[model samples]
Target: MNQASRDVIRPIRADEWPKAKELRLLALKDPVAPIAFLQTYEQAAAEPDSFWREQARESARGTRVRQFVAEGLEEIWSGTVAVLIEDAGSDDAFGGAVLQRQAHIVGVFVRPEYRGSGVIDELFEAAVGWAWSVEEVARVRLYVHEDNARAESFYRRYGFMRSGETVPMKGDPSKEEREMVLDNPQLVSDIS
Candidate 1:
């Protein structure tokens, strides 16, 4: 990849989760953000460094979950994506529902300045690569707020199609979350 391109994508180091957490809080502060993220900045900011460390460790730990960051030469974080593998028969954060083995994508964000610069494509390349690299995963899926058209479009561009599944946001019965899935895990391709 070219310098400009290569400089944008990589895994968040175990030591960098503090910054990772910070940037994530920044992303949550965006205006259209509420519909994009499940957690609020206030909640994330209240977390201690140990919480951040545990999160980072789980992300980098072999397939339990992973976080990838898009950084520029100055090490500015421009984007990020995290994927969590849901084990079969284990209840997810949502409730009693269980999955055999599917990767759940979440915590996706791209800086406004870099939103259309192919930065996300690389970040996703790393994420989907890691997702597919796992053996038991049949697919990778994510939920988007029904009103988040921009994120819906980006997700569609990544080959994620609506699965006709919708769940009420945990605490908000008024809004629904739509599930989108990359049905063909083997088709993950290069960004450029």
Candidate 2:
């Protein structure tokens, strides 16, 4: 396959559970895993195959949830991002009330070699586009570890801004994750 075709970014298929599990495992092994993700490699690796399959199926297709992967040459996934819908009046994973319908981006990771090659840019573009297309989605949001400057910088570059809210990281009271958000660009354009 041609190089251009090798780097396509697209939604994963429901049956691609193995690929999803593989990419997630790889993400957990990254140097920033502890601060970058809430789950440990050991915990995820110990999950049964059925769990992975169910996760893949649920996120593969639906307006409420979506997972996108950047497939590199030879069809290996080089990066992935998942979006979970948070409805208004409901409690978020952090125990905070969800004030608006939003897409909560999670599990973002790109292979080390693909980090500076625009792979992440493409992934965010796709994820944010999907979020905005969904009905009543006011924004897209993600939380980054306070000490993860590199990730925070990229989120800012992608048009997200610190929301001035921080939640204590799970299992670690000393570390906090800061919320960042990107208001729907179409709304910005309309108001301009």
Q: Using TM-score as the measure, which candidate wins?
A: 2
Clashes of 1: 1
- Per-residue lDDT over 89-149 for candidate 2, one digit per residue giving the tens place of the 0 to 100 score: 9999899999999999999999887777788888888899899999888899999999999
TM-scores of the candidates in the order shown: 0.90, 0.94
> What's the lDDT of the predicted structure labeled candidate 2?
0.90
lDDT, candidate 1, residue 140? 87
Q: Give the winner by lDDT.
A: 2
Give the TM-score comparing model 1 with the true structure, all chains together. 0.90
Candidate 2 matches the true fold with a TM-score of 0.94
Model 2 poorest ten-residue lDDT run: 1-10
Candidate 1 residue-wise lDDT, 129-171, digit = tens: 8888888677888999888999999999988999898888756
lDDT score for residue 129 of model 1: 85
lDDT of every predicted structure (CA atoms): 0.82, 0.90
